[model samples]
Target chain A: MAAEVEVVKNKQVLLKDYVTGFPKESDVIISTENTISLKVPENSSGVLVKNLYLSCDPFMRGLMRKPAPNSRTPLPAYKPASPIYGFVVAKVVDSSHPKFKKDDLVWGLAGWEEYSLITETDLLFKIEHTDVPLSYYTGILGLAGITAYGGFYEVCNPKKGEKVFVSAASGAVGQLVGQFAKLTGCYVVGSAGSKEKVDLLKNKFGFDGAFNYKEEHDLDAALKRHFPQGIDIYFENVGGKMLDAVLLNMNMFGRIAVCGMISQYNLDEPEGVKNLMWLIHKRINMRGYSAAEYYPHYTKFLDLVLPHIREKKITYVEDIAEGLESVPAALAGLFSGRNVGKQVIVVARE
Target chain B: MAAEVEVVKNKQVLLKDYVTGFPKESDVIISTENTISLKVPENSSGVLVKNLYLSCDPFMRGLMRKPAPNSRTPLPAYKPASPIYGFVVAKVVDSSHPKFKKDDLVWGLAGWEEYSLITETDLLFKIEHTDVPLSYYTGILGLAGITAYGGFYEVCNPKKGEKVFVSAASGAVGQLVGQFAKLTGCYVVGSAGSKEKVDLLKNKFGFDGAFNYKEEHDLDAALKRHFPQGIDIYFENVGGKMLDAVLLNMNMFGRIAVCGMISQYNLDEPEGVKNLMWLIHKRINMRGYSAAEYYPHYTKFLDLVLPHIREKKITYVEDIAEGLESVPAALAGLFSGRNVGKQVIVVARE
Candidate 1:
């Protein structure tokens, strides 16, 4: 006879409706009406997990908006009144899959809920090392890290002594890219939203220089001051005005890696990048990429990053919230630059 | 003593002033006052050439405008009341440089005059095979051919059966790019301004299909109808609305080789490309390059294209205007798409 499964109340963060402009905490609802069985269904190749950590990412805001009519890759919209999904770290409570068993810790796409039945086992990656904080899997050890790695090393192909510039420098991917540039013996400068984040980038991350973009009235002048010789590699995170200024200040044969356009995501019409003619004059190569495309190299990226973290040569900062109730505000905080670093919600303690 | 060197009348096309908006024939003056020595200067390494053919390119319009204050590469603006300089095929009347002697055929940058004292002989290429038309060196056998070859094969990295599209389909670079795409076994489509040019693209160039972009009211709908599976490679010669529309119809992992943006050149304010978000969604790589960058590969390019010309696998067309007096009108006609193919001025007959 099969063992009986325990059923318990499951608290979830649900999307109320499609968001327009700036997302608010009221856009999502916290509900405790749902229940989950702490066991994989019989004959089902799935895993049941107790959700521990949920990631708050900028891309989530794009998902909140109604998909474009001709959107080639329309990410499935967050269903109204349903649990919102994102990257999460969880402990497996039960498993019918051959690779996972009870108590196997893992991280991948999951719901903002107390418990989740992960039928898409292919997306989940088993956590190998527990010495580090498990929440690191929600960011530094996961997709954000891969994005920084692939975008900088593979896409930009940074050379020693090259001048590198990164926007949103205090954020998850930007911070890591700055450190990676420093590690490769390149001169690195970063721009952030606040004085505190600027100091963090300079003192903690060991960036060559850091600036508060808000304080500078003219972005072009600020860039000219920082990159007097012009930027060799621009790791683009915040697009729009920043991109326009960067185009004017880019060196001949410069490379721009388009990771995300955070500033343009909320606007009804994206800001016009006026200085694109510079792409021709300077012979610039601008390419856009997603970290999900580099999943096959996840293990390669881990192998490169793990040793640096272990030796304290590299460090990661995360702004974390506690419990399922903090989920809405945590996610909304990303757009307003309310979070200092990688934003994570601790759904439950280990 | 050597035969007394003769001084001769030099007919020159001089820019009356820095132009704004659309260029007019009146903006340039045909000067007969200029005189040239039929001999190379003593103790100088310069080669004097009797100009035969001059090429009319869209980039010359940029040279006619006053240099931008913040321009990174301020291409020495055409001085008011001085003859403009452009690519020319000429006969070496006398030489002090070791590479050339009297009567040697060469093609490179020269003044738009009957005679030019070529001091910058380093950029000039000696005509080895007069078997092909010497005029071919002014275009398909010169910069335009290299631009198409390098931009298409090297930048686009096209694969067999990939969908390819070219804007300015009947113009100098676009015509060659269409032929190159067909050579690679790709499904090729082109966009021109007139029905005659469109027919030339389909019949003469052997493109799979062609469209007159001017007749199409809805650019995006035209792109969608033509590229139902979406464009894998877009050889961007005309920018503005065509680029915006192409962005919407691009397949995942599309590549756009930006050789020129003729549509934006004449406008005081260049049009903004709005659908750039498609870059991130589709993971597109858009690169801007110039033929000058590929000069070192000129020999390799000639080796590939000469055989095609001989075998009739490729052919070229030129809208020829006789004498230097027609230089201004020939140049201004480029902006209006009045020239059918490569526009060349017959400065003198071979």
Candidate 2:
């Protein structure tokens, strides 16, 4: 005995084609030809959501490239002229799943559109805390937070007084990791592409030291100057030459938690890691991890971080591009280092 | 009172010069000019030992090269006309240390000479349980064994039914790793340079499968064929191209225990690992370890491996060259894949 649901226009940012190199705003088209019902279909098990915020991450660039022949990750290719998918914060408008209900706010993977039919409800986590800004779920309170937590604590096993280094320091995960390192009483240094981000890392994020990598001609000398002894933990966000330099400066028994290799994503071929021999020479441990595998620890992470957020012990910086039409430009800006902190698109605010 | 021990001529293998590129037999010179006293110097905490077996490992090649300006490990440059140093099995002729006594059979770092005055007796481990072949101290029951045990069990954290892959399968560490993988109830594949080694890996070492990497035109294709479901554990003994290929074939959450990079040891410029990006894509854990770090686990490793050795569940192969005169050729042969198994120089027979 339910009333027939209203149908509405669904505006989406669609990929014009699979990108070759660095992506441009012109490569995506904002389309409003599609429509979606406001209610779940008869006998359907999916939840219908109104997308609010979408994340613009550097990893998204890798998705735009044609997958390698032997690529193990079988992430679905973006169909020409179809809406692409990424991490999204949404409101459940209609639901047939037992775990989710109407009007519940949740965060997980969804399409780059105003409305989405999420067939896979398992990945979606219902947002319980409403005191914080809802858009925080797009970055600091969601995947990026989990990534920083797991990569720094679990993978690196960081210790107090350890020398920690982070690349792409003002990005979503990097900014959080620097703060976490400080909380653990570790001496941390961060490298960013610009002076403003470097200043933000030192002044706002509370990192012990910060540097503009673009200004340093010799990364090895720069690292040597910053870490005279050597780096104990390296949160590797940018790969290629940065990784090569980090390898040379790593201390014995050092740990490198590989989160995302943003520098290598847009390249036709990844830059070779030349000094990997140091891995053997110094007895270093380098591990690569994805936030998806850490979903089980999400509640634990929330408990640890939420109190810090509420007490003002921790802070998150966001760079938001308003509306669905700005999605392409926001995503493209990630590669150019335009966004200062977490790049988010405010698709449709509740 | 002990009589003043007489000095005797010590036949030695001397380095002609700090080597560049692949080493040659002429790179080392046989010198009989050196002499050693049979007694430890009065009040000196040292052990005087007669060398019996000298181990020629791939790491020695790195020692021949001039150290890089920023090299972390400052191994002393091999002085011309002076005997080089490596792992050696020797009988203590005289001892001033409480832990070591006269006539104790021990193995540790020593000069490539007939007799050595070991100032640092701490590294020497007294050979207990002499029921096994004394020469076994050079390879199977020594550093090679410890490397395999710690790298596979501690570093790799191998699980039953996992798919394991090993490079340089016929060499000292790789041979042991393959056997240990089998003991763990894992599916194991190995790559060697020659067909004889390949056959030995399958028939003698009981590997599930093995291939001659030299014969295989495409290493990735070969790995794909052997590890159709992808590799869960990679015992990385040979780095460079093999490492690159293994990265492509690694399964999600795969562990790579890097024991050595024998292939890149002689190169002026080490080959770049191009597919390291797959490390992030697959959530792989690659760790580099050395036997030196696992000294604390020596007893535990012996407890696990000794039973297998006594029960004939495990076996070792040694390609031995007789006398100090043959040491140079034996060491040089390692680069050309001339040695079938563990390359040992039989300085003297007990």
lDDT (C-alpha) at residue B184 in model 2: 92
Model 1: number of backbone collisions: 0
Candidate 1 reaches a DockQ of 0.65
CA RMSD of each candidate after superposition: 1.4, 1.5
lDDT of 2 at A220: 94
Model 1, position A14: C-alpha lDDT score? 93
Q: Against the true structure, candidate 1 has what lDDT?
A: 0.90
lDDT of 2 by residue, A1-350 (tens): 87768999999989899898778888888998999999888878999999999988777787787666756464676778889999999999999999999999999989999999999887798999999999999988998999999999999998999999999989999999999999999999999999999989989999999999999999999999999999999999999999999999999999999998888877888888888888988899999988887889999999999999999888899999899989878888898888999999998889
Classified by CAPRI criteria, candidate 1 counts as: medium
Local error of candidate 2 at residue B159 (angstroms): 1.8
Q: What is each model's TM-score for chain A?
A: 0.98, 0.98
Q: Please give the range of 10 consecutive residues that has the lowest summed lDDT in model 1 chain B.
A: B68-77
RMSD of 1: 1.4
**TM-score of model number 1, chain B:** 0.98
